[model samples]
Target chain A: MNKFGIVMLYSILLFSNQIFGQFNALEKGVFSGSFESISQWYQDDNKIIVSVPQDKWATNNYLSLHYTFGKFYAGLQYEAYMPPLLGYSRKFDGSGVAHKFFSYRGDFMEITVGDFYEQFGSGLIFRAYENRQLGIDNALNGVNIRLKPSDFFSLKLVYGKQRKYFEESNGILRGLDGDLDIIKLFKIQKNIGLQIGASLLSHYELYTGADPLFPPTVNSYSGRLDFNSTRLTLSSEYVFKESDPLDLNYFWYKTGNALLLNAAYASNGLAMNLSLRRLENMDSRSERTATDTELMINFLPANTKQHKYSLANIYPYSAQVMGEIGGQYSVFYKIPTGSLLGGKYGTKLNFNYSVYYGLDTTFLGGTQGFESKYFAYGEELYYQDINFELDKKWSKAFKTVLGYMNQRYNKAQVDGGDYPIVNSDIVFFDFLVKFPKNRSIRTEIQHLSTKDDLKSWVAALIELNINPSWTIYAADMYNYGNAGEKVHYYNVGTSFVKNVHRIEISYSRQRESLMCVGGVCRQVPAFKGLTLNISSSF
Target chain B: MKKVRIILLVVSVLIALGNQSEAQTVLPNVMVESITGQEVSAMNFFNDGKPMIISFWATWCKPCILELDAISDEYDEWREETGVILLAVSIDDERSLASVKTLSAGRDWPFTIYLDKNQDLKRALNVVNVPHTFLLNGKGEIVWQHNSYVPGAEQELYEEILKLTENK
Candidate 1:
């Protein structure tokens, strides 16, 4: 046996006979789940969901087993699903368990080998991880080491391969990151603090395709700096990478060199954020391969507000890691108690606006036939948005929020292909009423207007909260414009919960898109049906 | 068309009602082939009654390559002590699978090799990228999983394997 192997074997035996001694009765069991019929009726064909079995099954049904003793943790899972009934996929017909190995020895560090998720410096240059409900898992199949030398400083280093669906890619990925909280480290500068970080990642993969100009290796580097004080805060970060023509392209063209810059500031209840991104053609994947949204060495956090309601999140913005220019500004204020606008309970007002437009082409200068790293190839802004919200409390039992929004989207960029520009105006109002004891009711009304697509829409929602254990929710979204486009979507749901366990049941006729968090994403076709969910952790 | 719709709906409703066995809903099985001419199947790995470690990787993935290189030195010991079976599967696609043999021989990897030529195994695992690993117990059921890699993570895996296989 190899030296490393020998060492590992001894370590296992020593810990086995020493730590656990015996398996706990709670650790043994056969866990399973099944979902034979799932229908997503909003698409053109009924077999849509069947084609992507893993996505459908992971979203619908699966089973996992977990057990732990002392410092050791282990888990296993089996996934099996039938063909999708509606807009789901049929090809996802396999199951495999994901494993995790974690070790925590005092304050030195905690390590996880095999498959693990990590984010460094806001995940600008590299972030590999998962968000199940979003169906996204970009876990690295390798090793991860974290060190916390002191309460004020932390360090992390990771190396491995990116996971593509169920398999690992052939390319290599390695990164090193360090974070130092200056204030805590110094002790005296508690209120006034600073933080700094840097990361370097290299991916080595040989060119396999017909592209002649591509290189066999690529490198990416990122750095961040931040300062925080009781009354003021500022943060700045930058990312850069070596150019590879074959892997970075968006409209069937070679990508160019790239770079990005971001800065933000805040004080009291007021904060402001600004960012300037200039990407020539920066797309990094494990196999140097590109899908709609995979293999990104950097993450673009939407500076714009993240919408919660379905309509607001409908045309959610995706950071253009290729090439784009944009900025954001926001202001917030809280009225003092006992004022007219505050209405004896105080009021809050917030305003935000953001715009994204095409960059000028003059910045990139290339050869006669060769592409430049910077160019404004397309016309029209990818997206633009603005919003304002006001919250007021009339009494201990009553509180409300009113908001307005305006947005513009270029059909060609996000949704793919050119159509027409999208212009929309929206208004919304929500109220929360508390009754005697632990009872509360929340209601929301929203209206949206646009000239293209659906034309106009109206939505209403009502929710009841019985503190400590139960919640009932109901809502409907109605499209009032466009002859046959007028569709009524409604949902009524209830939840029963206690501590770590929760059970939810709902019936609905809904029109919506599926969303994945982290780096995993899949379209969730619309459906009209009943659903049940139960989750518990021990 | 009307008849087809009715049939589909009826079938869906019936299936939903009869699927109480807790066996109908599962992520699809993703198959991968190894350079050694072994057909690595995910179905056989599920809930197999032994602690299993399946590492999804490729020859070109730099981090993955490094991770394997780092673990190879200790893998044998881990197996001897915990009886953990580590399956290293490659998703090199059809065009690149030809080079798998050369690469594995050059690196001298000791674990069992499997090839996922068509990437059928990757999609079933809900993997959007590479270098994902899954851990399973004696029943072939997945217990825990992690994505991405950092240095010194293999030691952590051994820790879990020991805890899992000790009393068995």
Candidate 2:
């Protein structure tokens, strides 16, 4: 329940493990857990446009403990925030037992109580999860039970109130899902595996608005089918929601719909995947009045390349809940080691392309916001990326990765339009050299030449490891395209690691930008500060 | 009342474990999805009672990929001596699920892999970072675990597997 209690419990666990080893002959269970604590000190710097709100110091900590014995398992998570970080929400400025659950999984059935997270079919219709960096925890706080009567049939039932901030949402949510293995169900000895599933989710809350057509409850249903073989896999899901007036949709009583499809083919040295999604008024939330990353009950993943490079991710994308159509296609190929293009080691070439367009819709004003035609695209382009990369190992001691990208980001459409559309060309290089005695050095260099927005920029990072124990990292990003003085953002840090404990301290100047994780974006203002991070596990 | 229930659950579990002490370190029976989008249980992945080396990783973590590559270089030699299998667990969220599938194919990883999209297994195993590896004996009990990566960490892992078979 508290830090002291947790430490005491762990001590008791360690003490009991010793006693049990001597007395209990048949059973020897294990207790394992980890904790991470971050502390930061902020200092104001008008030169870099960093403004620190009244508070200058912030710290956050989380400790989770899990115990497993035979078929029974229990876990507890404790979190403390002595005033959360700047970008993190203030609502988390407290200490408490964030999650606690007990579950028993048997051959025929599994049951859980307290807090739990789950998802169904690409999470297009329902997803309950926790993203600590984003300050979101929608874990169900009730009961969940799954029944596997046979190898072919599986069913699940869940009821709970969604977690919001430090508390639970007012509305109550309930869902039931059933999955059937068609091939196994019929005992059909076929090559391809077939599975189908259906889910019905509902949310209930008291009506507080005077609108006569406003419904106090919302219902959504989803169905999915999946087929897979040794080299091919296909999965599709469709969802529909009843008419409900909520803030996200201007309190208009409009129905919602969504469709997602993914198909892939893979061989020994080649693989390709394609994804398609269409969402129209499909923003589902627990509370009718919730808006903008609040009380979300479903997850609509943005079908775009999640770039690994810093500059490539500058213009990230989030799926529009109102109306959007998009898809992504990616291919990965490995040239054999002895081929003409492949030198001594095999060469890896990756190509990725993605595009999203706004829905072609006309507004009717008043309660009727707009109307759109299916399978029609507007002239507006939300985001696009054409990227290719090649990875090669020149020798046993050297390896390198080269990449190029062309991107078009519609600021008005993707980032709520504070600036003009930005088109950029990027080049990336990564080299790693390994020396004897487990020593290694890695360097990453990226250059983005943009004609708009922040203009052209260049970044370089180097990481040197003195083998098994110590590492030093440094990086700097400079914006040269900006007229007049060049703006530079730099950071240097060192980390020491031994066994399960790791500690890192760094001082850096951050650039103001929108950082995104899984299509969800958060604004991180420019700041000059010292950060300390520590992690330990047992 | 909530805190009390939590304490009660923990105490009850401790008592149960104390009373039902059993041999054979067992992997927790958690459900995870494979690359083909099929739901599978971790319990059935014991490799017919062979040694198992499980690694948790993410696409964005560069060190993790490096470590896996090093292990892949000698995977065949290790398999010859001990009937061991490698199980790679990708904790990539929905954003990078495509890459996980695509990379698995192009690289032709010679191991069984699963996706822990929501980190259920990662949390169950208390892995704090990517590149964390676990070595399990023939009995499926997790005998050794190490976090992070060094160039020759796999050698240490192999030694543990050798110790397991020797004890047998």
Which candidate leads the pack in lDDT?
Answer: 2
Q: What DockQ does predicted model 2 obtain?
A: 0.34
All candidates' TM-scores?
Answer: 0.64, 0.92
Alpha carbon lDDT of each predicted model: 0.56, 0.81
Residue A311 in model 2: lDDT: 84
- Interface RMSD for all numbered candidates: 21.2, 5.8
Residue A166, model 2: Cα distance from true site in angstroms: 1.8
Evaluated at residue B23, the lDDT of candidate 1 is: 20
The C-alpha stretches of model 1 lying farther than 4 A from their native spots are A1-59, A62-92, A149-154, A180-190, A209-213, A245-272, A275-278, A362-379, A512-522, B1-168
For model 2, residues A1-538, the per-residue Cα lDDT tens digits are: 4668756555555465564455334544556667787888999887786778787888777777776767888878877677787777778777677888999999889898989998876787788987766677789889989899998899988999888766889999999999999998889887778999999999998996677777788999999999989888888899999886787888777788898888888887799999888888998889877755777899876788877788888788878878899889999898987888887777888899999898898988877678888888877888889999998878778989999999999988777757777899999999988898778888999999998987899999998888767889999989989875587788999888776678899999888777777766667667889999877666
Tens-place lDDT digits, model 1, residues A432-456: 7877645778788998889886577
Which sections of candidate 2 miss by over 4 Å? A1-26, B1-25, B150-152, B162-168
